[model samples]
Structures are given as C-alpha cells and as structure tokens.
Target: MQDGLLYKLAALDSEFEQIHRLNYETFVEEIPQHGENPERRLVDKFHGENTYIVCLDGEELAGMLAVRDKRPFSLDQKLPGLDSYLPRSRSLCELRLLCVKKERRYRKVLLGLFTKLAAYCEEKKYDLAIISANVAQGKLYRNLGFIPFGPEVGSDGARYQPMYLTPESYYGMKERTKLLSRMDGEASVSQKHMNLLPGPVDVSADTERAMAGTPVSHRTEEFNEDLARVKQILSSITGAKHTAVLMGSGTLANDAVAAQLSLTEGNGLILSNGEFGERLIDHARRWGLSFCTIEKQWGGRFSREETEKALDKNPGASWLWAVHSETSTGVLNDAGMLGEICADRGIDLCLDCISSLGTVPLDLARVYMATGVSGKGLRSYPGLSFVFYNHEIASRPDKLPRYLDLGLYAESAGTPFTLSSNLLSALKASISNFSAEERYAELRKRSDWLREKLSDAGYDIVAEKGQESPAVITIPLPERLVSRVLGMKLERSGYYINWRSVYLLERNCVQIALMGECREDSLSPLIGLLRDEMKSRHRA
Candidate 1:
C-alpha cells in the first residue's frame, strides 16, 4: 500500500461499522473504557450527533475522532460546571473517541487527524474544543495545545482528564511544533503526488513552502518586484527581450499573440501538425486575422521545402507560427530551420513553446513571439501564462480584451488587475531552484534513457528517432492492449501517464511527459513499472 494517508470526514452507514469496531477495539478491549459486548462493536452514545473525522490508510480505518456540540456533552455530564473549568468561549464543542491503530500509532496519524479536526472546528465557528483525554496519553494532549481543566473524572477504574483547546491555542501550538520540529531537524513529510504530467508538476518542498507563505496583494510593490523578477528569469532563460506574465492558461497566451497579430497590417501563415498547432489556428481564426495554413499530418515534421513553398506562395504573409514541441504528438518541430527560413525571408516567426520553455534548450532571439505557462516545463502551478516577445507589443488594438492584451499586462508590470501572490512565489521558487539550461539537460538525459528502455521492451515509439522532443514520449500500444485501461491502472498506482485524449486514443498511444520536477533516479523505476504493466497485460 502507498504510505500516504488521508484524513477526511467519515461517511455515515459506509463507515459506521468500522468506526464502531475501532471504538470497541480502543475504548473497550484496549483501554477498558466500556464493557465488552458480543456484538464486537461499541457505539458511542452521541454517535448520531457526532461528526466523525477519520484517518484512512487506503480505505482501511487507521484512526478516528468524533466531534459533537449537542447540549449536555459527555464532558458536561462528567463535570457539572464545565464553563468554570474551561475558558470563556462563544461556541464550544467536545472531542471524543480519538483512536489510532496499533500499527499506525507511531506515524503522523494523530497529527493528520488533529489538523483536519482543527480545520473542521474552525470552519464551524467553534471557538473552543473540550476533550476528555485518556490519562495514558496526557502528554500527547498537552503537546497538542490542550490545557488541563477541572479534575479527573471517570468510573469503573477508568480515569480521564478534561482538557480544552482554543483556536488560538491550537494555532500557537502548531507554530511551536513547526519550530521544534525544525530545531530537531525534522522536516514535514510530503504526501504530494508523483506528478509526471506536462503541467502542474511535482512541487519541491521549498516551492510549496513559498506558496504557503503569507499571501500579499498583487498591487503591492513587493509583489511587483517578485513579478518583475519572474519575467526577468523567463527572459534570461528564453533569450527574449520582453516577457509578459498573464493570469491565464497557454491558450490565453497564444490568443494574446494572435491579438497582437491582429494589429499588424500583414497576414500570417499558421503551420498545423498537432492539436496545439490546430488550436493556434483556432485562435488566429477567432482573432479574425487573415492567415493561411500549411497543414501536415500529426507527428509529421515540416520540411524546409514545403515551408518555404508555403511562405513563397503567400508573399504577403509576414508571420510564421508553429508549435516548437507538439505536446500531443511528442514531435519536436525543426524550429532552427523554420527560424532561419523566416529570418532569410524577412518574415516574423512565432512559436508555441509552452511545452519546451524549460524542458528543451531555446534561444528565442530569432522568434518574434512565443507562449508559455507557469506550469508544464517551468515546474510551477497553472493559472499563469507568459508571452515572450522580442519587441514591445504595447498599444496594439485597444479593442482587444483587457485580460488578453499583452501590452496592458506589460504596462501594469504583469498584474493588469489582480494576480495571485501564491502562484508568483511558487513560480519564483521553482525557477530559482534550477536553471533552465540545467533542467533541459536533465530532461534530455532522462528522455534518452526512457526511450532506450522502452525500445528494448518492444514498445512502438511515436516521434521516430531524431524528431522526438526530449520532454514527452508517445508510445502506441499493441492491438490487444488498451491504452486508457493501462493508463488508469498506472494512475491508481500513483503513476500518471497521459492517455485517452482524442489524439492519443486515435493513435492508440499514451504519453509520458518528462518535464518538471522529474528526477533521474525515478526514470528507471518508471520504466520498470511500465514494463511490468505491459507484461501483465500481454499475459492476460
């Protein structure tokens, strides 16, 4: 089983029996808090009124706690004057039945449970939490910010201490715990996904922490400084003169490029070889730009002859657009050739470098415009797209949508209205952690290793040999195998391989993206898993 554990609200009927059984195991058999029943389950008196918080170890009950605010709480019955025992509060609730399985006791089960419970109570507007803690774990309660109240109260040789934890106390104790953990050289255990997708990659601890920092207003000078740094980093990485950060997806960035093109007097040529390239055509059409298309089969490379022929055919075309790395087909188009052609012909070159921005080596000095996102190869979260241009695109069509206008974003220092500080901080952390050139080298090495391994395993690779992008590998499954089924199986095992999209399904392929937060050591294990999965499917 995966080591990751989940803390969530316990579902009634579905989880009641397990909750009762666990309660019996802890309160009756283990702690002797209740009399043993032949039913093998111990139902709490306030079960109906309780909101159960459960810690799950892959659908197995690992630990549980129940919270209730019904009048005359169990603690109230035990202590007549509960208000005097606890501090004054506007809203009060009692915590009960905190239990952890023996196997999971040493893990962070209690910590996770308490974290969820604290959030739940706070959301319900509970100012204070009262609990009758078993005297055996008194130290744990005290460590969790629960203050001992009144005297001990119990019956039948069972003893308990009444304790209360206010929101302030809980938060204060959380800070103390973090500080102590850090002092003790203990790091927070991450339960993040092993992200192998093209976007929203696996975030490093530093990036996560940066995002968790206090959020600031986007209009502040502090945020603008960070935003300026981010744009500078992008420019440095891509060799673009000016980069604009917009709070949207890559499609929006591409649309912004199209919007800029709309301001130009000359028509452009759009090259389509895959989904994203076709989407650029859509963007151009939507922008109502007079553009001609040079369409090619998916996964096919654009030859200089045909490209030049198309450009010659449309002498009025001032711009040539293509996806540098077609994400859907895993084909890395010949940008060098295309850029040279555009330069020789005095035509502007635009690229959809969303997937290649950091995963592949790029020098955008020759290109006039490009689109990228904070996610994908940049190793940051979604919701931020960047438009890298060599020259100023300001004052281009005042009729364009404000949000999609690159000039407006540049004028406002990348925050036209409101942007997310968390996203910006995370992007800064991601880019700062590794240089773009270093990331590109790593991706190339990993992709080569994976391709060699997959080839040895007899998988049919999509992009052929030299035409493939180092960032993504598309593998077509055999006739007997189902691409999406295997993809789902791998997903259940916490390994995400892109599959089942229209392009992939039509091609009977699944894609493995080698971008963003992927480690070299993880490549072999992933290959081994893929081999095993394929073998199993073949055997069946």
Candidate 2:
C-alpha cells in the first residue's frame, strides 16, 4: 500500500469504471457476499448519476463508495423493514456499496471513507444516514457508533442488521475519526481534499493557553498597557521605535501611509514589480496624490543603478512607495537598498511589508513608514494592521482626519481606539513565541530547508538563491502542467501551497510559503510524490 491515499468524487466515463472495478474487487471477490455476478457487476441506473468517491493510493486505485437520496430505498416494497426505520418526511442520505481491497483493510480505509460520508451528509444538510449494515460487518458498524434500531431481517439468504445514524451522532463520530486520523498519519493525507487546508505546524501549547482567557475592553487602561507592551515588542523585533496597531486590514495601513507621506510638493514615485506594489499605486491614485511609476515585470527586480536612474528622473518626487514582499509572485524587493536611495534623495520611503515583516529581516530606522498585518508572517488571526513610522511623521500637525490620524493612535499608545480585544490577545500570544533574533534565524533556516528539498527533487526555484525572502520559496513549474491542475494535485497530497497568479502563468511558477509546522522528514515523501506525479504525466 502507498503511504498516501486521497479521496475525491469520481467523474464520469473511464474514472467511473475504475471505481466500479475497485468496488467489485473488494465487495464481491474478497468479502463474503450473497449477490450473484458480484465479481463482474456493472452499475447502470445509479452508476453515473449519484455522488461517489474514489480513493487513490498514489496513481493506483484503492477503493470507492456511492451515496444517494434515501427515498428510493425507503420506497422499496422488498425492503419494508429497512424503510420503516427511515424518516418519511425528513430528508436522508443513503450510503451504499462501501468497499476496500483486502490488502488495504488494515489501514482503516473503511473508517476514513465512512467519516467522509458522514461529513458530506452534514454539509449537505441531510437529516440522517439509513443503511443496511452487512451481517459480517455489523460489529464494525456498531464500533463506528451506529445503533441498530429496527428489527433484524434476512436478505438474499444472509442475515442483515438495519442501522441508522443521526446527523449529530455522525458528527460526533467524525470528531473521533479526526483525532484517530491525526495519530495514524492520515490527517495530512486527507487535508488535500479540504477547501481551507490546515497548516502542518500546530500552534504552541503556551500560545493556546494564553488565548484561553476572557476578552478585555479595548478602552480600558489595562488594555492600553497590554497594547503598549505588544507594540514595544513588535518595535523591538522590527527595529522600529514607533509602531501603531489599527483596527482594520493591512490595506488600511497602506492607505494611511499613502495619505500621510504624499504631502510633498511633487508627484510620488511608485515602484511596480508585483501585485502589492501595483496596489500602492492604486491607493495613491484614489487619494489623488500626484504619482509616476517605474514599472517592471512581475518577477523582475530593480538593480541599484536602475533605481538610481528612476529616482534621478523623478527628482521632484518626495515619497517612493514599494512592496517589500510581493505575495502574488512570491518576490521580495530590496527594501534596504530602496530605503537608502529614498533617504539620500530626501524622499520619504513608504513600504508595504504586510507579508514580510515577521519572516524577513526589517529595520524601520531606514524605512520612513511601513505597513504590516497581524496575520501572514506574524502567524496571528487576521483583522488588524500596524503602521510603523518615525516620530517626525507622527508629530506632523496637519490636522489629519480622525480615522487616518496617526496622532490619535500614538496618543493612546495603540489602544483607546476601536479595536478587537480577542484579536489583540491572539497577536500578543503569537508574538510572544520568539525573540527577534530567534524568529529571523528560524525563518531563514526553514526557508533554506524547503528550497533545498525542492531543489533536490529536481524542481527549479523561482526566485534566485540568497536574494529571495525567507518567507516563501517559489518554484518554476514544468511546461506541461498548468498552475490550476498542479494546485489540485498538490492539494490531494495533503500540502496546501499557493500558486502564482494567472498573470504570471506564462512564467509557470508555483509558490510554497514556510508558514506551517511542516517538518524536514515529511519533505522527502512529498518530493517523492511530486516526482511520481510528474513521471506519470510524462508517460501519459
């Protein structure tokens, strides 16, 4: 058996036939059955119409099952005993023909399959699951928390138990299955099919414990002290003396910086290399700030000479805006170099470091103003952004708008304003995990490890080594596979990595960020899977 098995709804035609063959092998040949011609059964009425899932052990078939509305089975005259137990008015889903090969039985393939079925029932708002439990497998169903409520009956000369499971009981079983799946190394394998994939890194026990307390009032003095402490810690980590947390997203921080810093007599010089950089320009335009752009390709980086020339051309510019890390293309711009140039030219440097601050080394001493999010590199929940600036910018007595006023945040010491105490607690807990130097070292080590693993797997890293940010590693994909298809494949392998945008599809790039608790040991198996997938595609 393969180390991994992914389950997905089987499509029509060839894939459907493959699932039927696997079911025949498991249910008819290996398991005890009374149905005739079970070995060569061809599903006709219910084969292509209903929802069915196929389990794959790498590129090979493993098992399958079908689910359909329970009404048809409930109306059957031949199965009156089973029909009586099923609710007539309430909607129910029936599980049918669940099968697994003999070799894969010990791996709990049946349990995982049933767990998925239960989750599906709950998601589809089904009231109950009505099934005719096989006589030989009655004990297994009972162990799975299925209760036999109706009278026993004999079918096809074989005894069977009528069992049903409620939605609540089904979810209770799902929770237990999730716990067992984690222990059995199947949680990671099953995560590929989920929509919002959970990261491999588990939150620290200390952080979890810290977040267990009750929420506090953001307007209170105690909350003010807590907010100040968090800001001081963030400042120490990023080498910024003045950091103010806002009540909105990172975009608000970016807009705040654009609003305040574009006060110069001339147009702002906006650098466009990726999505975030382009967004800065958009913010500037919306605010009606005079601006000019020094545009580059998505993955392209600006050399010191090119930057100097751009600055020289826009000599009247008072502010230069850029993104430290472009999340869209997984590109990290040279903030330090850009900061120095802006300072030299008497231009205030405003940076969008939303995705870079926690994972990448940053110094606010060089940067005039910057924006960061509580999520992303900070590893906290979303809904807050921080704008860090020098005292000179904060002290500007321009009578700024109440919401965009940096002075209000500074006066309150990042509290007394409208803020979410729960998110603030989460941020404080997330930041307390490591010291500044420790976080920098960890980010660099993890990024380098992932890059080395992908490189050893015969894949090309999108960003050049040494110049890339420690937050994410982007890979240039093979020509044959599109980003969407590759994303679906990797998702099935239980690793949820980001793909480059549609605009960068021509570049054939895929990105993996080091945000989760993925270990070095797991990388080998993941690489092996990628290799096998690519090889199979070539053969096809």
Top model number, TM-score: 2
lDDT of each: 0.82, 0.69
The Cα error of candidate 2 at residue 384, in Å, is 2.1
The RMSD (Cα, Å) of candidate 1 is: 10.0
Q: Could you tally the backbone clashes for each prediction?
A: 0, 2
TM-score of 2: 0.74
Question: Any residue pairs clashing in model 2, and if so which?
Answer: 192-491, 201-517
lDDT for 536 (candidate 2): 55
Q: Model 2: per-residue lDDT, tens digit, 1-540?
A: 124766555532445667766665655565545244735754635664467756767656677777888356622543665556665537777666777776777645666566556556656788877666777889888767677866666555445677777766655765776654453355334443322111222344555665676878887777777788788778887887798788888889987887676565777788888767788888988888987888987678878898888778877888788888877666788888888888778887888988887877788877778898876777776778999877555534564567777767776644647787777887788887556677778778877887786776678765677667777776777767667778766664445666635644656666677654455655554566566656656777
Error at 302, model 2, angstroms: 1.2
